[model samples]
Target chain A: MSEKTLTYEQINDELLGMLERPHPSYFLLLLGFLLALGLFVLSLAIQIDVGIGYSGISHPIGWGVYITNFVFWIGIGHAGTLISAVFYLTRAPWRTAIYRGAEAMTVFAVMTAGLFPLLHTGRPWLAYWLIPYPNQRMLWVNFKSPLVWDVFAVSTYLTVSVLFFMIGLIPDIAIMRDDAILKGKKLKALIFTPLSFFWRGTNHQWLHYMRAYLIYAAIATPLVFSVHSIVSWDFAMATLPGWHTTIFAPYFVAGAIFSGLAMVMTVLIPMRVVFGLEKYITDHVVQSVCRVILFTSIIVGYAYFSEFFIGWYSGDVFERSIFYFRPFGAMKEWTLLGDQSIGFPQVAFFLMVFCNVIAPIPLWRWKIRNNIMAVWIICGLINVGMWFERFNIVGSSLQRDFLPSAWGSYWPTIIEFGITVGSFGFFFTLFTLFSKSLPAMAIMEMKESAHPPMRKETHG
Target chain B: MGKFSGVWASFEYLDETTEAIEKIRKQGKQPQVLSPCPRHEIDHALGEPQTRLPFISLIFGGLGCLTGYSFPAWTASDWVLPVSGKPIVAIPPFTIIGFELTILFTAIFTLAGMIGLIVIDTFRNPLPKGAKKYPRFQRDRFGVVVSCEPSQTKEFEELLKAHGAEEVHVENS
Candidate 1:
């Protein structure tokens, strides 16, 4: 099933054939996610009803699981644009098969990421106050605030990603429209017609389409770097020891790309199997992605080492103490059940290190990277590790900030855990729906990469 | 077929399609080529100018950058709220807003320009009648459509067949 053997017709049938009918397993998987979404909704309802106090976020550890989830989800989104825009600009051919899914993942992950800041704001309804609209009070959002920057950065990322995704879909959707008309699916044709924007594949339309798409990729490339850098600023701009550092921007960006590539593998490996896209999403593509993940993982590990090195070398006691506390901090006497507990922050630090750094080292081997199951498992570990990485950064830094009396352990409540699980449910639900509804792979791009059908003899 | 005077030719091969387009062009007709995907060969044969989308994006993106910085500066000045002993309008911090807005505005208006140009072209040079019947043009086939007088339609159809057109349809007025 080499891509070289695939003609345009075969590619169309294999790709578009995915949208034709769903297997029962698809429904079952969707149902599982919907049930999880129900848990998310139930948790949100309780939080809104009982007040934000129900969550474990207390005085010093004000940002807990919600903020961690926010950063984690946003990090997960970075790979999409990285693969779509960055790889596109570089002319990476392997990107054609898998980037569409990555782009979709980005949109959904960002959509999920956006919920946290709203959820973090005890009154989600007044979230609009972050906007700089004129009001009777004549108040404006402090542009100097990193939090305000997050608001602008995240919104702009979401908008730009969606537009880029839809613009890429036009030519493919036109194929879907034609396929529907051929099958005499009047209903589908009616729906796809407008979605395709009446695309006729005319040279006039394509000339402009090509230019516009290139411009989008160009703009979006910078956006991918900026959004995450700005997110890191939310911490870096702060004066807190571990939270405030110049290295956070690049460190966070690398960690984001690391985690995001892992998430892309987490979704794509399963999708490639389920949709029978072996020829398109080949092992070469998987290995290429693994190399990126491995490269980024090295950067993340270096960032971790540098943070510790700087803390020790800079002779800043507060920084030195926070770095020490991250791994060997004392646990609070009280736990979720009012019992003595192990040091959760230390455990988080170790887990993050083990998952983010140690787990990915196996991928350095050619055989290991080629093993899809092994790659998938390691990717799962990276996902867990990356989340703990954020948890460690957000929770541990705040737990023991400046004074002894201010030191307190942060443990997520049952409600917080529920919402976290629910976020997964929401993300998966949207993704599963997207897989069935749209062309998960970029069809036209695939054809462009393939050897076009040519006659044996040229006509003079 | 009243008031319809054109010829539509379909080819199964890319080279043949480009060859057909070249042959049609040599006869003083600027034929329209349709493809399932963008091809450098077709673009070369068509010889259209580079698109103006970049200019649109640049103009709007610059506007956005100005507005992003100035709006925040003006608001901070009007309100006169200063924190952390920073200036009333900090250029460094506002630069983030400017950067984000530059990308946002560039993307939105670039999209608008693309759609606007497509719409204008669609109205000015609508696809030939019976083009919809050749849905293969959207999937696998390549098409060469030429508008001509009824007297010349037969000659054009023969030219298309001579150059490896798998199918040719004549539209008559």
Candidate 2:
């Protein structure tokens, strides 16, 4: 028997039905959020009143969990604009399904990323001092700082992405405008109205939309690539032995996309259930993204080896010593100081190989890719592995730099861990609200996806 | 006075342009067939009429390319100093930057051209304050708008009737 199609009323009734008691998982998710939020607040407040000086942030490991989280979050944000604009322009059809959610996630994630650096600052209020405000202080912003470049790059990338996302929404707003189902409802239309930009979806309007989408995609592609590479430049620009390398740009960018894709899969799991949109975003589409994961995994693998090979080939002792010390440093001191790592680099290499390289090999097979449960499980492991990979690169490297005296091991303090979880809470809260409210997928894009303009049949 | 007028239908999902051409040939009517999607097939169906769109795209794409590269370069180079030890003006990096700008300009220009040519952006639903013969068009609906000379309205209406039009109406515009 055919299941009766649920009308807008039924869907709404079901949705509204849940609001009375909140979600079954809502209490748990909320409790986690509160605990995390409280811890983050306490951490920052203590630090601000006292200082990041109070934490384990010492000389050699200048950047601790704060900066690491910042980089990781920003990297995760990369895949969204990359999918929306870059993939769209290239005519990757699967993009229409997953791109919207990821794009929204991108905006929120960037916002989350922007928070950490500020929190980690010596004076949070004076953070604006970093920007060159034309106040009478006669103070000039440092033009030669990678941090300065980051402010501009990340902000510009965010602005352009928001513009692009809003531009795409204009036609849909018109549809919603005429839709009787949406009569007398106002859903923060203030944000949406500017986006609509008075779009009417007429032939002329469509023409404009098509042109805008293509051009924006084109502009955004490089911006997306540049943002993460620039983020890596923050590390590469530093004079640290392992961090300062030409290979850092490509290496960081590849790792970014690798982790970013894993995130996309993780987000997709919850989104599929809540939106009742399994059909719109299918297992086949989910599996197709694994190919991206596989490809990026290999590239990151090459970059990892490439960095080590280059270090050996160039015969740079400082670089070699730092690399060696990361994992198998002569820890005759028997302390887990920066000096006492038991093969951190080797461990990093194998762990990355396992998580990013080997673990994904099962996905190459058709069965595993198609298995929704297995896909979700793999995507979860992939995310955990990605976090570890970042730890190995940033954390371990910080603990074991060229100067052993300055080097020290750093772990995320209670507050540090809390803030990280808080960021996740913020991301999820925004995403959950977005999914529940907005059309989970782009209806217009999906409509067009199944029936694109056909190529003319050729005759010899 | 302009001569031919009639209605036509085509399988938009499957052989769209040919079906349109065959229908037009049978009636021998010089009617217009505006499709939801712009395709080369439609151009063939309409005898591949010359349009200034491609030229517009080229000109605009060029303009976009120029601006995308130059604007950022100028801002980062002449207007601003180098953020890192990197030079005041970075050219190699412009490959992605330049490419993106060109696409941006082309899109904007194309939009302007579309509004200027198709005249849809100006359409505040000017036909009537609340006229909706086909609300479905707001969603997934597509069609060929078969417009002919006003004198041939009767035959055109009949032709539209014969081709199994779900609905038909006269346009005030």
Candidate 3:
């Protein structure tokens, strides 16, 4: 653990330099992602052209890969608000270095998640019907359904997250504006000067700026908890045995924060490596993030336990079947994720438990927690685990429902898998571009935190 | 009329800038302090007024909540679409919309308030002629721009230099 202190000029020069001259690898990485993005778009087009029938979704398992991907992406989005808003409100200083990336992740994750519902809706053309508006049809959106609640929840989450991300950037942009003028980057100066809002660091402007920032943080805090809870209700509101559970809300919220924190590390580790931001990002920040991951992992572990315990204790047949079948039931015939006839996906269940619950156990040791490689590996595992968690939740539950006759298994078609991979490509593409454009680290806030003002007596 | 001349002095440290602002205030001249970052001490020393952003956000949030609840309630009642035999204006489910809207509106109001305040302040007292663009103030330096008559320029410059100014320049209007 090196405690390397950085100066304002050093920080400015190192971070802003990325924007000035990108590394060769940057273009190569982006080109690869662009290819993936093109492939993803192609898959989406094919799905649309061929219709929803191209998907593995069938009766009783209508929500397959699309819904799972939706939940997974939305879960990944959680850590952003948690890091930027919740940690700030709680007075955590370490968040200053890593929050910019996490916040950007949240925005992009939501953007990616926003697409799934439309994709899931076979008639993408009529997706606007989800919005409540007056038209010749006079048909209004149903406000009572949890699905309707989801439309409101996800959209509001996206809007607020974007605003928070941009608001946090104004001071940094002002810095860029000034730096541009000094460096004689005419084009950058022309673009950033106006966007800087002519900020002169006046007393009045600072006063309003600080107040507005605090209020935004205050409002965004609850949203960190609410948006995911509503997403959970999309399942909990249903009458299905595995879906309808009182524990679903908190359970889903905890899992969301858990997965989101892991994603932050996943994004930041490579980021720090490429950008050479180790001095600013530091081992201490990684340790802090890992500690949060450990805490959330414990909560998720508890939720997993409580869910099964309740299922067994309630003695409900349907609940018991879903629970028992999740971890134990091996099948001579089963549906693989890609719709292939397979032996059993019972492995996914145990893998989910191992990744989510057991993998984080190493983080309990300070030595392992501080080790970047170890943290990175564990965080990556958590990402995989959380995805499996969603898969098990959506797939296992639908695999064996109340009526054995209505029960069936689901495997994502090639299109589903391709679209899933493409979503990551989309996320990374936006993030890579974002890394170069704005101050990836909030320069102004970092400066404020690192070097606060020192008062001096008046000289008369 | 070019009657007033502005002397802008750059300080390497915040302490020097704060001291300069206080000295200028004692001399009955309001000096503007610019730095790369915002400081609470500077705001306190200048007696900056509190922002109305919190209040505005609250008002908008309340209105949004009301609209969130009323629009759904009204539409449900008007359309008479009872879901699962539950009341058209089901209070339990309506809270979700209300909660979401509250967050949405607060964010909207807060953003609007911030931009409005900055723009209004910028328009009311546009930056001093040459004071409009100083890049160093956003670097590791602080600036104090004093507005005074042309005759006071030499005095202000001497005052700043004596106190400790790395560089001093003047812009006359």
- lDDT per residue for candidate 2 within A212-321, as digits (tens), equals 56766776887787788888878887777778889888788888888888888899876676545565577667877888988888888898788778777879877776
For each candidate in the order shown, give its overall lDDT on alpha carbons.
Answer: 0.90, 0.64, 0.84
By summed lDDT, the worst window of 10 consecutive residues in model 3 chain A runs over: A334-343
- Candidate 1, residue A350: the lDDT equals 97
TM-score of each: 0.96, 0.77, 0.94
For DockQ, the strongest prediction is 1
Docking class of 3: medium
Measured by TM-score, how close is model 2 to the native structure?
0.77
Per-model chain B TM-scores are: 0.91, 0.51, 0.85
TM-score of chain A of each: 0.96, 0.86, 0.94
Q: What is the lDDT of residue A240 in candidate 3?
A: 88
lDDT (Cα) of model 3? 0.84
lDDT (0-100) at residue A333 of candidate 3? 41
Better of 1 and 2 by DockQ: 1
Q: How does model 3 do on interface RMSD, in angstroms?
A: 2.0
TM-score of chain A of 1: 0.96
Please tell me which predicted candidate would have the highest TM-score against the true structure: 1
Kindly list the per-residue Cα lDDT of model 1 for residues A1-460, writing each as its tens digit. Answer: 6676689999988899889789999999999999999999999999988889999999998999999999999999999999999999999888888999999999999999999999899999999999999899888888888999999999999999999999999999999999989889889889999999989999888999999989999999999999999999999988998999999999989999999999999999999888888899999999999999999999999999999999999999889888987886643432333324447788899999999999999999999999999999999999999999999999988887777766777889999999999999999999999999999999998888877888864432
Candidate 2 regions with alpha-carbon error over 4 angstroms: A1-51, A130-140, A181-198, A273-276, A329-353, A451-460, B1-120, B123-134, B143-159, B171-173
